[model samples]
Target: MRTIAVTRYVTPLREGGSLPAIAEGDDGFLYVLKFRGAGQGTKALIAELIGGMIAKLLGLKVPELVYATIDEAFGRTEPDEEIQDLLKASVGLNIGVHYLSGSITYDPNVIQPDPQTASRIVWMDAFLTNVDRTCRNTNMLMWYKELWVIDHGACLYFHHSWDDWEAQSLKPFAAIKDHVLLPFAKELNAADQWAREKIDKSVLDAIVELIPDDWLSAESKLSFDEQRTVYKTFLWNRFTHSSIFLNQAIDARKALI
Candidate 1:
């Protein structure tokens, strides 16, 4: 439960576009952190922490994460800095998906993700409400010839507030009809089994246990735990009931074959 302190706020990196960025520290690590949007709410904050952890648990090579606290002295002084310093005290973490190296942005065509690989990301996003990707620009990370997706602070269905998330609402994502879908629809369709296998109760319990008490109010902790229990149950018992989801994943991979 060691909350990383904001050592020195460095210049913002612009590649993240809408997301805020800066340098920060923990007991012994230096990271370029990404903050959730201003007044966004705890759901998004927890998503970055919990979602990153879950992705790691699922054996995805997501970036390392440690909960961070932002203080007033490090607050922003300009429009560009506003998002980074949104809360007088806020939580954030660094993403290892990409860096501010001399070169940025890669051609998706050159580093094509197979339907299975692409579907896995889409499946992760659907469960998380990570709307950063779409038909137009995937905006995923490409480093050392690998695809790494970052910037999930806006996930976990933040748009739904703290209410119990509906899985059917997540079904639309299973359909195949567009540029992004065309590439990975079958794989997305076939992912119901994977989702069922991956989103297990034991894993969900581990995630809740990892949340530091300081990051949550007593009431919030109660609600979050309740909701997580519900979510885990639904994913395990009912997620694969949708034929479209399983079919989209099948179609996604079929395109590649």
Candidate 2:
């Protein structure tokens, strides 16, 4: 385990409804330090680190992330002191999320990716355990003419446990429903097929093993491992028995991108 000490706590820049950004690490890295806020919790922090890391491993574009522990002293106020005290009182916060530079924000409708491209992102999200992309918010970034997804701190299908399965709610996340209807479905299917064949039990296990233990402490790490197991199991099941959706996503991605 590599332990990087906290060097300095920088002022936070608010983005959307997400956590505040704090500190520029000695290593020239920027991190969003999750303070004890109105709604922040351990689950969100864990999900962000684990989900982002998993997406990177799945060969998708994601921001670099590192876990950090902030102490009370680092949470003191600045000269401006306009910021809320609790917002700065995070010790042992998630730090070192790469602050993207020269990135432009665009509404989901503005970037208008083709159906194929959109399908690929959907497939990627489904396979990598992302559960945050929804109708109201498709959090993404456009830089250098490329669309990059962010704020996956709500992934891992934690809500799947709820059995409500309302029609409207299901429609949004049913990767099956969205991707299969895409015109680019066929191509996305082919790509997913190829990737699926390459993925085996050992490979999945190896990927899970690479997760940093520091990010999830001993007890929490165990729970995190269980989540990975469920993720892999669901992935295999979907690829084997429900491949139609996967195919559609692949084709859709090709058309959009």
Candidate 3:
């Protein structure tokens, strides 16, 4: 992933608890900065990185992700106390998504995608165990006639508690019922075949490598190597047993219709 320095903080996108900001990067591109110091902390950034990459691998459209650096003194002139504190805490490294200018939030009622596309989106979310992407807050955007996914910080909920990650990997995702695209995801079986053909364990290994040790070492009780191993193991277990969640999604869609 490319690294860029944030040149200026444009504005706060006060949507959820995490105060993501629209900022200018040194490369003259605008990015939506997901601060390391946000309430969810760097774990969210890890999810964003890994989940976004997996979506891309499955032929889904996700904005480009980069490592965004912030100079320690950059936030010194900020006037807002809350934002100032956030900036101060996030001085080191953060995750940034290429901002899609003029894009609008996806309105499910207004735009309907084909059955295959919708099924693929639903399958991806279920496989990741993402809790967001509900109808009320579809973390999707419409950019230039294409659907773009964003804000995957809420995926991989098993990481929040490593108590039984192996077993959690095989668990069915009940939340698929609430997915914004579920109603249109009529081809989930085909989506499962897509996963079988397009993704593999090696792809996950590369995505896990993208996570910075600094983020893993910040608050995790596990060693850096242990953390990496856990992520790889958990994801692989889930990938091998995608049928569990795929069935869960089918049942949920049946209930929906």
Question: Who is ahead in TM-score, 1 or 3?
Answer: 3
The 10 consecutive residues of candidate 2 with the worst lDDT sum are 164-173
Question: Against the hidden reference, what TM-scores do the models get?
Answer: 0.69, 0.66, 0.98
Q: Highest lDDT: give the candidate number.
A: 3
lDDT against the true structure, per candidate, is 0.53, 0.53, 0.92
lDDT of 3 by residue, 1-257 (tens): 99999999999999897899999999999999999999988889999999999889988989999999999998889999999999999988899999999999999999998898899999999989999999789999999999999999999988878889888988999999999999999999999999889888888898998889888855678899889999999889988999999999999999999
Candidate order by decreasing TM-score = 3, 1, 2
Residue range 1-257, candidate 1, lDDT tens digits: 34577676556655434444555564555555655433444545555666676666555556567566666555665454455455343544322222433333545656567766766666666555455565465545665666665566655553345454444434544433333534644456555457667776677667656654443445654565665565455444334344544455455546645
Candidate number with the higher lDDT (1 or 3): 3
Lowest summed lDDT over 10 consecutive residues: which window, candidate 1? Answer: 94-103
Q: Write the per-residue lDDT of candidate 2 for residues 1-257, one digit (tens) a residue.
A: 13344566676666544456666665666655544332444445555655566556545566677656655566465454535454354455454566678877535545566544554566666554454565555656677877666676656454334243222222323453333224333445544555565556676556556444444444543376665565455545544543545544444445555
**What is the C-alpha RMSD, rounded to one decimal, of candidate 3?**
0.9
Error of 2 at 211 (Å): 5.1
Residue-pair clashes, model 1 = 19
